[model samples]
Structure formats: C-alpha cells, structure tokens
Target: MRSAPLLLLLALTPPLLRAPEGNQTRIGPAWSDSRNPIVTTFSGKRLDLWSLRPLTKAPPKRSIDAFLGTTNARTTDKRSLARRLSFDLTGLPPTQSDLASFTTAAAYGDKLLGRRSYGEHQARLWLDVVRYSDSNGFDWDEFRPLAWRFRDYVVRSFNADKPYDRFITEQLAGDELVAGKPKTAADQDALLATSYLRLGPWDNSAGLFGEANRVRNALMNDLVETTGTAFLGLTMACARCHDHKTEPLAQKDFYRFRAFFEGVTFRDDLSLALASDQEPLKGLLVTDGDKPPATTHVLAGGDLNQPKEEVSFGFPTVLDPNPVALCKPVREKSTGRRLTLARWIVAKENPLTARVLVNRIWQQHFGEGLVATPGDFGYAGARPKNQALLDFLARYFRDSGWSVKKLHRLIVSSRAYQSTQSPRRLSAEQLRDAVLQTSGQLTERHGGPPIWPPLPDEVLKANPAFLDDNKEKTKSWYPSPPERLGVRSLYLVQKRTVAIPLMATFDLPDNAVSCSRRTTSTVAPQALTLLNNPFLTDASLVFAKRVEKSPEADKVAVAFVLALQRVPRLDERRLCEDLLKKHGIPALCRALFNLNEFVYLD
Candidate 1:
C-alpha cells in the first residue's frame, strides 16, 4: 500500500524546477544568441549564430563592438534594445525609470551593461535535474509543510553562491562523509542532502514485491538517475529494462550500475525529520529509506511480477569500458550496495561525472548549456552545443575540484554574463516578485515553514480541491498559520494537488519527479495573474507601503532604494512626483511598483 503523503514526503525526489524540453525539442526554437560574445564566454551558439539567423539582420551590439569597436557605426535601435535588455536582466518589463536609466547610460555607451534593478533575477537550472519536489508524491499528493527546508536550502545555496563540490558531496554521500558512525547536526544536514535519494514515483499500490525489495529498487533507481544526470550526463533510464538502444550502455551495464544500489532502500533517507512544539516546524519525522535483503533478477519484462533468469548485481559495462567482474556484498542480507555504487559513480575514470555537473553550472548562469540537454548526453540527445567547450569546462570543473562558486564568479564577472539581457524576457514569476521587491516590497525574512498566499477561486473551483490555503483542512500547499505568511517561495508548503496557476503556467512541474529545466511560456493566463492575482495585488500595495512606511527624509528616495536598490534620478523623481500629484502617494507608489523597471534587473 502507498504510504501517507507525509511518509512519502520522507521519500520523493526534490521538486523539479521544470522545462520546455520535450516541447522545445518538437517545436525547435532557435538557440538564442542574445548574450554578448567574449572569448571568455563559451555558449556554442556564438559560432552558430549566422547559420541560425538571417544574414541580412544587423548584429548584436557586442558583436559589432567586437568587430568594429565603439568607434564604428555599431548603431543600436533604442526601443528594441531597451526592452530586450531589460527582459534578459530582470525577467520583467520596463518602466519610465528603467528607460531613463538605460537612456542615460546608453548615451555614454554603458546602458546595455545590463540593468541593476533585478527583482528576484537569477534562475537555477539544476533543481529540475535533481527533481526537487516540496511535497512527497504518492497515491494522494500529500502536503509536506517542511519540504520547504530543502527548497530553501537550494535557493539559499544559489543566493550564497555556494561551491559546487561541497554541494554535490553533501547530497550524494552526505551521510557517508559524516565524521562519526552516528551523524551529528552538521552531519545530518549533509546526510539529509541525500534526501535526493528518496525522490521519484513508486507504484507500490499493488503491494506486489516483498516489502523490503520494493523500497530497495525505488531507492536504487533514485541513486542511479541522480548520478547519471548530476555527473555522467547520461540517462540511466535507458539502461533500466534493456541494453541502451542508442548509447553504448548495454542491458548488463544498466544492471551493473544498478548493482551499486541493489541493496539500498527508502529507509536509507539521510535527512530524518524531527518534530516539536517549537516556533517553526522542522521536517516530517522520518527514517532513512534503508532497504531489506532481496534477490536480483533480470525481470523477464523488467517487471518485478515476472520471474526470469536470476542475476547477480554488477556495474554497467558502458561505464566500465574496461569491464570488471561484478561482485555481490559479503552481507547475507542487503548489501551496503549503494556505498560501493556511489564510489564508482564518483570515480575519476568515469568520463561523464565531472562534465555533467560543470555543464549544469554553466547552464545556470547563461540560461543555456554547453550541452543543451543537461540530463541526456547520449546519442539520442543533441550533441554538446559545443563539444570542445563542454570538454574544456568539464576539465576545468574536475581540475578545480568542482568549485561552483568559483565558476559563477568566473562567469558573472565576464562581459558575456554581465552583458545586456535582450530579445527574450525573464519568466512571469520573476517579473511579479522582482517588481514587488524593486518597488520595496520584497520581504527579507528567511527560513521556517511555508505560508499560503491567496489562491484563485476559479482555479480552486476548476480543480475542485476542497483544501483551504489558510488552514490544514486538506493540506494546502502553503497552509502556514496566518502569522507566518512572509516565508520565501522556497518556504511555501508544497502539495502536488494543485500548483499555483501562474507558477504552473511558467511550467512548474507536478512535482512528480526531478525536473531539470522549467519552460518559459508566454500566455494570456500569465497576464491575468499579473492583473488580478491577489498575491500580485497584495505585493503592489505592500511595496507601496514599504516605500512610504519610513519617516520623510526623502520618502521618494527611500522608496526607490527599497524598490530598486538604487536612488531615484531626477527624471524618475519628477515622474514619481507627477504620479503622486495626479493619483496621490498611494496610487503613485502602486503604479510605480507595477512598472517593468521595478521588476526587471537590466
């Protein structure tokens, strides 16, 4: 029988950030070349640009500057350039103030440097790869109020510019790396990082397998998929039932890889949750999803229900190019199988591991990857958009000991990363939230339980979910007590029952599995969210209040600083004064907060 959703919470993949991959592949959008080109920045599309675009089209500013320098007629169209640049930087539209800043800067050949008023700007791509879900997905999508812990963990990690190596080890073998046999608080946090293991859907409703073996296979699949994507850049799912059809991996290789985690179980969950009457609730009480003893068989149809030839566990041959004979553990019961498996997956000789993670880091900053498909690096997948560059960056990641933060600095500091945002705009979530923040409405509070913001009556009615966001009536996604409404989006309680419509429109997944990329969709529903969503309305008003909340030592200046994180220019000041004069302070503040300038970064 399926466990309670709470129990599943202790089990399931991290929430997926999501993407338009499946659709994007079918529709085939051109590889965007909006970024500035620097030798230091290696998005493969640079060389592919002319081939993809009309040759007659004018070149990007960075391209013009590179060829002819500023002295040449590297003329840029202002309106298009500003809109394009703003969208790229902040994920929002432009406002009068934004135009003012950009025009002033543009005149001096500095405007396209990118905007500084990013509202919740940067988006992390790896979360989807890891398959992050706040709620534990099971028979009934249950609410995990504290799943936000992991969500916040990821956001904070990105915000802090956490190093990649430590991040990986902590999640992969966090419990293994702990100092003592008994994990400590620090050790547990690291171990909990492996909560990455418990993510995925389990079809245990039939109660078919021996209790222990099902958990074992479920956990093993997690370990394998996670390793394949996070490191090797392969989709081990190809190897699950048979030899990989296209990739060099053979069916035996899949089993061999499975051999490593053959003995793992849901009970091995490293991040066991604790409970209390404390101010902020912690994780749901849980045990490591450790498995019990079981046999390894080549399920005739890869079906646990079917009996076939019995097979001893071993590593996949595709990974083992040299081919080592497989061995089972000495323990009569379950093998400490995953321990050995994790060892081999992270081994240096394995070519794909380091490359995959490095590619991910690159994808995070540039909005694209050396290998556009982060999880699938096989024959069916697109070749590395730039193989040489992918290899170079991979080697750098491996040689540098997987320092993610170092890579970020290396990237962001580059003129390429710091280049203007153009052509494409940021996602709607970024727009709304960032606008609120830039308008001086972003809440500074960090961790604790997730809170429910208001929900749409139509959405609720359409879905027929009786759950109340304000109460635990049916485990609302953000059912935090009224007092705790200010938690980060990461802190919002997760329920697979129904996603926030705007978020779903932005391609927030069902949280059923780890998703590597979230798709960017331009739809009218999003416009509706901006225009009428209670959350957006509240954010605008809250931002307005925050700007005016302080005593008047230059209320407008304080407002601008809080909203835009910068002082208001004369033009902006005049605009605000006119707005206040026309509609009064509250209306003007509300209007300014709605401007694209307040939300976008560039």
Candidate 2:
C-alpha cells in the first residue's frame, strides 16, 4: 500500500514512460527507494560508462601525433597554415605581410597566443558556454549595466593564462574566496568572477504571483544545469523530473547537486574600489544571501508545488560514492557549499573537468572535439574516436600546472593540429571582426562597456520597445559613437529581445541557455546580410579605399591577400579583374566579402 501522494504521483507521471506508436514496450517509472530515497546507486554495467570512469593513468606520450598512430599526416600549405593559425588563436585573418613572413607553425602559434586578441577571441567562447548577456531574458528584458565587468574579467583571465583549476574555483566560488569586503583589484576580480553564476537568463518582471520562489527555483535550475554542462560535461538537468533515461543519474542526484547552490542569491549593490583610481565600482555577484539556506527537496515531476523528500549538499553518487562533509565557515555570511563543490570539481581524482576542457580547446582548433558532444559525456553522447589521445591531452593539461596556454601550445604545435582538414565557417564575431580588420578600420580597443552598433530600421521597428520612448533611456538601444562602433563584435551589446541583425543572421547563440557549440547554418539571409548590411557596405567601401592605394594591376592580388591571405589564382585573378573593371572597387570588395573563402578557414 502506498501513500495517497505517491498514488497521485503515479497517476500524474509524465509521458516519459509511455510507449511510442510503433514500439510495443512501455518503459517503467523510475525506481525510488522507500528507506533511503536519496541514496541511489548504479549497476556495475551502468557505472562502466567511459566518461563516468576514472581518467586513464597511461604514461604520457611524446607527441599528440603519436596517439593518432599516423606517421605522415599531410601539412597544410604555409599560406593556409598562417591563415588558420591567425584565426584559431586571435580570430583575425593574417595580414598581407604575414603571408610573406611565414615562419614555423610553433613560433607563430606562440606569438599569436601572447597577443591580447587571443584573450578577446577565447573569452567569446567562454561567454557563449556561460550564456553571458547584457539583459534579463524574459519580457521587459531589463538591462544589466554592470554585467560587462564579468566579460572583462574573463578576457583578463585568458590573457593572463590563468590556471584552469583556479579559474574554475574563482568563477564558481569567487565570492567566498575572500573573507570580508574586497580590498584589492585581485579581490574585486574574484567577486566579479562569481558573476558567472548570475549570467543565465533571468526574469524579474512585476505582477507575477509566487514570483519569489518561482524565480529562485528557476535560477537554481539554471545554475545547476550550466555548472554541470560547463564543468562536468554532463546533462545532469535531464534527471530533474525523474531518473535520467540513459544516464546513471537519478532524480535525487539532481536535487542533491542543486542543494550545493541552495543558498545562492544575487548581490547587486557590492561596492569595490578600483586599484587604478580608488573609485567605487558597483558589482553584480552571487552570494549566500546572508541567511541560512532553505531545505532543498526533490519535487515530484519537478514541480515546486509537490515537494517530496529533502536533499542535502552532495555530488552525484556515480562520480563519488562517499558523501562530502561540509565545514563551518569562520564567518557565517556564506554556507560554503559552492567552495566545497568547486574544489571537488577541480580535484585531481575527478575525471571529467580536465578532459572536458581539453576537448573544448581541441574543438576550437579542429572544428570538432575528440568527443563530438562536448557538453554531454554521457551514455547517449558520441564516444571519442581517439580516447587515448583525449586522455593524453587531459593528463598533459593537468600535469602542466593546468596552464591553458601551455595546453594550447602543445595542441597547436602537433602535426595533427596543422594537418589539412575541412574548412570551418567563421563564427559571427569572427566574421564581423574580420571585415573590420580587412578594412583596416578595426578599433583594437581593450575592454570596456558593450557597444551598441546601429541597427537597420526594420530591425528597430520589429522590436519597437527597444527604441527610445523618451520616458526610459535604460530600456532603449542607442548606437555607440562612430569612433567606438568599429570595436570588435565581442564587445557588442547582447540584448535578449533584439539581437543584432548580422549576428542573428549568422547564428549567434541566444544566451537563453549554456551553448556548448554554435550551430552553423547556410541560409539566404546570411548572404543578404553580407551583401546589404550597412556595416558591411561601410566596411567594403573602406576596404576598397585601402586596396585602391595599390597599383591598378596589383589591386586584385592585394585584395585577395588581404581578404583570403593568399595570392589570387590565375582564373580567380581574371574573374576578379573583370568584375573590378565593370563596377567600382567597392563592388569588387563587396563581392570578395561574400565569398566563402573570406568567411571560412582552410
């Protein structure tokens, strides 16, 4: 005999157990232990999931190519290699001079890694994974003015080549890293890093009932899901409603993992003095809300109204069978749950973090990770083609002081990395920045507040509320000054309601959730955006002017080198010359910008 609530839950069970139209078997409900509901264990076979097992302890290999078991991988041409290295490291095309002065790939990679542009480019990837945005996502999409500091902090961390373990610790528990108020810029940066916790889309609009609890639960869910995907490479959120269908995670595991963040709440009014001027800067960060955490429960069907058994702070049993013990903080301002969880994630014994991070770096360079599904290293995710190589890189990354730059050097120096492969489409930011760079109009400015570039009238009218209504300036989108507009697209304001036209056309992630990888789509609008967008038109004109400075006969070769980082082939030279003669240099430049070669890496 079951309790009335349990019977009701059975009746209200979600469609997860229902059979498909053609499938005869109906899946059963998730098993729940009556005596110890939170202590779920997996079968031996389930525990053997490759990603769930401990990382291989094989002796370090001499070279990455050695793991591939290929002695003679064909290297790309020096020109293509130079272009690839430039874009992979710095998200820009190589200049005309770069093609002529090509050196060994290792030296070029090291030089590019040290540039500030490397941080700017790498930070964009991190921001996408964390879903950084300038506005709250739901209706009334209010602006978050101080969120840009987190963006700048990420850029600085990458530029400094911050250790991966410390990076994880800071972002996850930066608010708790310091005892009292932040005194130095380093302390302020730690607090700013905690902004990663608050980067998910938020809804704080008025007039909603149960808004407080609803918003809190939604935020916690986001935090748990993002942290799991971003750090553990697991789809832990799938178990929220019931046990995960494929993975070993139980519903109780979701609640238990979430309990670590049960006390987190936003602190929007933190005042920290800047190291340069001692000026007070307001901070937006996550904290323990200066109160004891509420009890976390496994809600029936993940509904807040139907809370079941309470769960405490613990990791997934599949990963760590032993329960984590919490220590009382000397200062009672925080529960210290996040710091504990952060340390556990970066612990040497943990198999997922270093592997996941190394896979991401591999993905950035090769256009696909060894594990193709970066965020889902679970039963259903694609298995790594070369597990040995993945393990070697993971071990190397961890043993080398967890230095991302060192890992990058090891990877890009490998013959496996430099070998010719499929072309990768330029990311939205990369495309925009490349156009500006080719035009010699890129501002190359360091971090500041996000810029708002001019939008087409149609785009503005599509979201009329984003236009200035005279009553509220904060709710509107105003274009930055012309001088500032040429800054890299990574610095552009990301409004949830109104995406920049060119970015949306080119598949910018919406920032609604953590994006493991951006989808690449070839569509008519992308062509239209490239040809007709005012920014592109302006850039094309600027590029034409730059090309016109060359001798008339050499303009085609000059444009090819500037845009594609290669000399024009005989056939390409003739076609481009005819086009250049028919229309002005601007039209020739526009045509070059629209070419697949200009927007992809060989």
Candidate 3:
C-alpha cells in the first residue's frame, strides 16, 4: 500500500530528469584578458588616490573630466539637466519650476532621491536583475500570492537606503539573523528578504526521467545561478560539470556553494492555500532545518547518479585561494552554514562585492557600464573601459557606508553623469507610466498584491485560457475594477506565461533569468500599438479632456507641458494648434503622445 501511494505521487508530480545538456562551460568570444592581476590584488579601496599620506596625491578628476570632455564641456543648462535628472531619478518628467529652479543639479538630485517615487523607479530596475515574478513560471503558471510582500520589502529598502552589506546578509540568511519567531515589523521585513532565494521560474510537472531529485537539482541550479550572477558577477553555474574554462571557479567550489542551500524547504503549499495569504509579512516563503542534508557530492559530469566525491560546506576556492574558516562552528541545533556564506560574500576582504555593486549603479545611471557586461566580471567578461574610474566609484561606494542614495548623489553630481543625455527608447514600464502620467491618471498607491492593467484584444485572443466567460471575464488573467487600472507599472501582475502586449512589444524581459540589460528595437508593431491600442487611445482622450479647458492659444503649450514636460517650440506649437483646429483635442493629444521625444529619454 505504501509503495502504491509513492508510485502514484511520483506519477502525479513529474520531474525533468535528464543529465544537463546545454549547461556547458565556455570562454566568451570577447574574453581575451590574459593577466588576472585584479583577481589577486584588487581590494576595492582608494587609499592610494587620497591625499592623506605625505607622497600620495588627491583623487584626480582626470578620468571623469576626460570622459565628459569637461575642458570643452558647455555649461549644464539647468532646465535640461533637471529634465534628465527627473527621468533618471524618478521615472517622471520634471515640473516647470523644477526645470526653472535656482537649485544646483546636486541639490535637485538629493531632493528627487528623497521622494517615494524614486525608490519605485530604482526597485523596478532591480526587479529585472532579480527575475521577480508574481507567478511561478512554467506551464501551469500558478499565482505566487505572497510574493508581493517581498516586492514591497525591496521598495522600502531602497527608499531607506539600507546598507548593501546588511541587505545581502538578511536576504541570504534572514531566519538566522532574527532570533526566535518573527513578531515585529522589522523581523517580518528581514524574514521576507529571503524570498530572493525563491524567485526563479519553477515547473512542477514531472519531466523525462520523473524523479524528485531531478526536480530538486533544477531548483538548486537556479538558486546558484541567480546568486552568482546577481552578487559575485561570476557564472558559478558554469563550473557544475567541469571547472570553469575561462574563470577561476572550480567544480569543487560549485558543489561546496551548493551545500549551503541543501537544508531549505520551499513549500509549494504556501501558494495553494488561502491561509497562506494571512500574515504574509509575518510568515516566510522558505523554511530551513538544523540538519541540512548530511552529504553533498561532486556529481561526475553533472550527473546526480554518478557522485564522484563528497564535499564539505565552504566558499569558492579561486576567490579565497584557501579553505574559508567558518565564522563559528555549526551548531548542534542548526547547520548555520548560510549565515557564514553571507558573511564571506559581504566581507571587506571580498574584492568582487563592492566592485559588482558600483558597476551596477554606474550602469543604472549611464546607458552602459564601465564594464559592459554588468553581471560577469571574470576573465570571460569585458575589460573595464576605465579601470581608475571604476575603482574610484567602487571605493567611494564602500567608504560612504554602502548607502545607495549617497552613491546616487556622488555619481549624479559628477560632470560625466551631467553630460548630454543619450536618447534611448523608453523601457516598457516607463512607457506605461508615461501614458498614465499624461492622462492625469498616475496614482501614488504603493504595496499589496499586483494590479491587473487592461490588456489588448490581441493578447486576449492569443491566450483564451484567461477569457472564459463564466470564470469572471477580462482581457487579462486577473480582472480588475475600472478604477484600479492606473496603478504604477511596478504593481502590474507579472504572469511569465502571459506577457502583457504593451510590455512584450516594448521588450519587457522574459523573467526567466537575470537580465542585466534590455534590447531596444524600433519596429512597426510598436507604432501600431501606440496608434491603435485601446489603452493608448483611451488615455489620449483623457489627456485631451485635461487640457481642453485651456484657451486655444495656450492649449498647444499646455499639452506640450503635460506630455513632454516642456513648452513646445513656436513651429511645433503652430503644428499642434493646426491639428487641434482641423481635427479635435483627441487627435492633438494622440499626436503629442506619439512624439519620438515624448517616449525617448533626453
């Protein structure tokens, strides 16, 4: 009887059982660096550049000035800088007075960074990097109702400018960080941060060989990849089968890292029960036992069945160059391995943590990173274009107490950051937010479950599974009241299997892996969506209504201010006025919304 139930359970929950096929290690084509000097000597410090010593000179502005061409640089016009800063900092255009204010760029940046909206803007970028989703990705695409708690936690952390090191410690080992059961708000927030470990796409359906170990291995692989790429800037997953061909990571190092996570119990039931929604902030998405799996082995050729040798919990060998002595012995009650690993990652002696973080911050501000490959900083990654500038920023980031907001101020205050804005296509979220802003429909509501924005008819037609009439009809997977449609794009439900038409058309990431950057494309579908999508068309009418009360002479100017955040040039104003007279307010508003400058960053 027991064997029958076990067999039935195995049949019901299929696993993807197969040796890894595509997870091969390879040196990237661009990786030509022969000398790995930085891996050994890099301290992420700037003591040599400071003027504290007798022979040492002050930090030179040569790299920054040269990058900006500051000698020949034109004065940063306040209005132009304000517009750029507003978009970069808050994901919204500046107000008229914000453009005209006597405040310097640094002062304005400080103010913008203090706003609640700034954190939302920053969190959205981090969301892409973390593979955040409201639904489990595979075929079933079940809802992750409790995931919103984690999302809100991220927003709060960014707004508070939580120390990056502490942030890492909490996310990786929050349960260990907190004593006793979680009760207070601070305890709940710490517990929720560990949701970082559970963010990857998961499939419950049994696959090929159909076994529990296969399923568990797949989940473990995702956790390893996310941690490596997001924090250490190395593709540690590449070392699973063989030693990394280009980077210094070894196969033993991979297994040792994998050992840390063996004790975690990720409950699928957490999403299946209504009770799971109660006290979401107070509850945890994962549970860890004191006795982690007693053994982890070097799987020969990444084959679970062919274990070669058992490995103990430890840090990567290449980075440490020796075995890492744990901060404390494993307790009789618990393994306590995760907290130890977290400490190693954020330690002052770790060369990659500060460097990787500062590089990501640089990428967020500029269109590109000094190291173009933001996630991979190994020998397989691009060489930093300006090593001194990269080091300078990394050192300052650490020295300034790992405060993300302070780092933001330092970078934005530089001449390089205030340089002429390079026009790029608006991101999917930015486009959605822009539409809401122009129509005067943008809302400040924050936190809670994701909102379901109206989707296009084509998207509904493609995914008829969501269109059942008796099942509460809507074009999207989740139906919402009309008033709930205009929440921030950050709050929009992200069903990985069901892509939002507007977001898909504008290159929203697939959310299947860590996405350091998004591809920008100019295509006919984007134009068609802008011109014909009901979301855009309806928003245009609402926008027209908001500007309709203005006098005809001022209507064009008002529309320009509302849509583009600037007054229109005389010729542009004349063209818009002609359209308003010949056609109507709707047509003029639609035309303004469709402008290239309206959607692209200045």
Top lDDT hit? 2
lDDT string for model 2 (176-286, tens) is 887677778778888889999888877766337657778888889999999999999999888889988778788888998999999888777776665576456887677
RMSD of each: 13.4, 8.2, 11.8
Across 85-173, the per-residue lDDT of candidate 1 in tens digits comes to: 44444344445565666643233223322232231233234545666555555544545544555555565555544556566655655
- Consecutive 10-residue window with the lowest summed lDDT within model 2: 30-39
On TM-score, the candidate that comes out on top is 2
Ranking by TM-score: 2, 3, 1
Candidate 2: stretches off by over 4 Å = 1-45, 206-210, 274-276, 327-332, 467-472, 551-553
Error of 2 at 107 (Å): 0.3
- Which stretches in model 3 have alpha-carbon errors above 4 Å? 1-72, 100-102, 207-210, 267-284, 328-332, 461-476, 550-553
User: What's the C-alpha lDDT at position 483 in model 2?
Assistant: 89
Candidate 3 Cα deviation (angstroms), residue 222: 0.9
At residue 409, candidate 2 shows an lDDT of: 92
lDDT (Cα) of model 1: 0.50
Model 2 residue 188 CA deviation (Å) reads 1.3
